[model samples]
Target: MFPQSPSIASASNVDILIVDDEPTNLRVLSTIVRSYGYQVRQAISGIVALRAVQIQPPDLILLDIMMPEMDGYRVCEQLKFNSETKDIPIIFLSSLVSGMDKAKAFQLGGADYITKPFQVEEVLVRIDYQLTLRTLQIQLQQKNNRLREQNERLKQEIEIRQQTEVELRRSEAQLQGRTQQLQQALDELKLAQTQLAQSEKMSSLGQIAAGIAHEINNPIGFIYGNLDYASEYMEALINIINLYNKYYPQPHPEIAKRIQVSELDFVLKDFPKVLKSMLVGAERIRDIVLSMRYFSGYDQAYAQQEDIHIGLDSTLIILQSRIKEQTNRVAIEVKKEYGEIPPVNCYSGRLNQVFMNLLSNAIDAIEEKLEVVEEPFHPIIKICTQLSNSSKQFQDKNTQWVEIRIADNGIGIAPQIQRSIFDPFFTTKPVGKGTGLGLFISYSIIVEQHNGQLQCNSEVGKGTEILIRLPIEVPQSLDVSTTRKVKIAPSSLSLESDIGEM
Candidate 1:
């Protein structure tokens, strides 16, 4: 039926198995496969084909559908069920060329189909297509496995990175917290250093003032005592002259000549007035010395009951030289509107310093305004004191407050600068002219030291008013230690109109 031996040149290395019950069909298919350079195998039945595949799997199988012991469908099903041979390509080659038969072959995992008595070229082409498909499938499966491995590695790397990020965030939070704590400690230390320096400076100034005042007192007392004696001596001499005139109606010629030369009547008339003037000048000096002594009482650190007005008077007296009229400008007029308020419990020396700063600043403002104003301007500093009943209505009803308003008609502070005027080392004056610690220390004294309120209100080109509200009785609970901490909150200085201008 077929060639007994077909001579063909081998051009490829593909392995192909041909299964058929007829020897002619098997021989014809094998010869055609070998001519295409494929290694060929033969199986007489479906059972034999399956056994051949189990023993040695081929790249592709050409199966005949109608077989003796087992059919091609059953053999293909068996081959597909076997994991070892499932991936191998199977093509149906049969004499029965019905559509149903081809469908059954395909359903059982056949890769292709060829009818019996097929042309040699068609069979060879079908086998070549199947072998190529199998090779491509194998390559595709290997690539899929590699991708799966790479995907697993990528997942592990992503998880590790996520864990690293979490740890880094935790470390950052801890470092941030530590940085904040260090910053807070540094700030507190700076504040303490500033306060200590200020206190030492004030203490030194107080000691100097006390020493000068003491030194001045000695000379003043001697001058004052001598003046009183000098006045009495002059009075006694005048009396003696008067008595002599009374005893003798007519003077001796020598005596009369000397008396006339001296102008006795005129001397007698102005002698009392001269003594009175000297006494007045001495008394005034004494008053100034006393004010200095009161102002320089640094040893009086503890709170004591003292006349607030006395401190105000002493401060004004000390600044009297600045308040006087100069050749270039008119004198700054000071108006006092004192109310009937009792003595306040306070640190007298510190309170005096507050008064001095406020008054001095008021004078400076007026002097600054004098330079720009064209109209007739009277520099006025108005000081008012009043006992406020408003505090009695507060939560602490027993607390009595005295409000003191120091107002000046000068070049007013701008709204922006007014807010930070009390901040330490913040000054509007030129360098070396102001240290900017005046108002800051004053605020500390009134608020921190005396538990009071200091507020300011100003209008540009108009004037400024500083209001001080001090408790009549200092709080007993405050620590008097030199190292006592003062808590100053931001925005502590209230800007409000609590006192009206004079």
Candidate 2:
């Protein structure tokens, strides 16, 4: 076993080149290196050594400084300068035992230097030391190269993660915006569906009411016309009975007995009253039919000149049942301040719907208030209409307008929610009681269709006042006088008596 070999397995197949001018020295070094289980090549000169290294590079080299043609210093310089051979360990074997020469050998990239007649033990020790050092350096370099590759991969991964995070944030923002858009669209769709349902229902109701009114008008007209003649005939018959009694005062007892049994006196006294009551009843029926026909307005196909007062009255007549006295509250009072406004050109049916929605809401508010308020709270709706020749709201100075204000003495809307009252599907009423499309449709009919304005003024505890301003469409031939204010005194419209018949 070699004394300086790290292991027999490590020394296997290790190639070394020995160069000198002396054949004996080359043989000796080669033999010694080969005995340590290393493959050796011999060169008698430095030139031969360079050629052998160029042909097939070795792991280690042992060179003599005193070679011919090319010295060990020159060979070492040539090997160290080459990129492929620079890492090979070089040892200097020389007879010159000077410190300067050793220094010179090391400066020329020599690994170790040995004197002439050196011990084999020293030669092997130096070779083993240099080989072990180079092996450790190679392993460290390999580890450094692996660490650098890992760091590069980690850097790339970090970059990819950062990009992914940025994309995720962008996607989240887009999703949020899209969600809001979808929600808005869904709300709009709901509002539209409810409004369509309400419109269809109202249209059907109008048709039914118009049909009923038409059917009743014929019979009521006939009964109303004949009632007067029947009353006159009854009067004549009573006169004949009286005259016959005067002429036949001395009649048979059987005739007088029959008269007494028939209660002729009571008939004579009550016959006229019964006819009068029938006449009154027939008249009331006629009035009700007329009111129903007017309120239905299903036959009105186009915009025409209409009296706003009549529209309001027709809507009130239709809603009279709701305004009637409840168990907890008295009948609601309506105060009208009608101005001398001319007939307005408008869609009477749609205008009536607007009035209906507003008054209905007013009644609902009053009823809601009645729930919490004590007695003595007389709920009232104040309606005021005014005509103006010129207004700042009108773009044309000469144009005229009709302004209406409907106010109530009930629990008012909060200020924060007032602005949204006209928005579709916005309501404070209980679920089944309100569809929330009343005000929204009313707003559309007034502002969008009629080119008018609808605004609300309210306080939380006091009440709400909704003002409507519409431009009056004056006809060519119709004469409208100067604006004059007409006020109707406040009156209680108690529908308690009328609701039963309705």
Question: How does candidate 1 fare on TM-score?
Answer: 0.71
Worst 10 residues of 1 by lDDT: 1-10
* Residue 172 displacement (Å), model 1: 11
Candidate 2 per-residue lDDT over residues 233-270, each given as its tens digit = 99899999999988888778998888899898998999
Q: Per-residue alpha-carbon lDDT of model 1 for 1-502, expressed as tens digits?
A: 2212111223345667889999988887788778656688899998888889989898778888888779888899999999999988888877787888888888889998888679887776666566656666777787898998899999899999989999999999999989998997776577667766766776777788778889989998998989989888999999998999999859889999988999999999999998888889988988888888888875474788888888899889889999999888999999998999989988888888889889988898888889889997878998889888554323566677898888899888887787688877778888988778788878888888788888777776777888888988896555534443443423323433332344
Q: What TM value does model 2 have? A: 0.62
Q: Give the lDDT of residue 142 in candidate 1.
A: 78
Off by over 4 Å in 2: 1-8, 17-32, 41-57, 61-123, 141-193, 220-291, 294-309, 339-351, 386-403, 415-427, 440-454, 469-502
For model 1 the local lDDT of residue 148 reads 89
lDDT of 1 at 25: 80
Clashing pairs for model 1 are none
Give the C-alpha miss distance for residue 422 in model 1, angstroms.
3.0
Model 1 backbone overlap count: 0
* lDDT for predicted candidate 2 compared with the true structure: 0.78
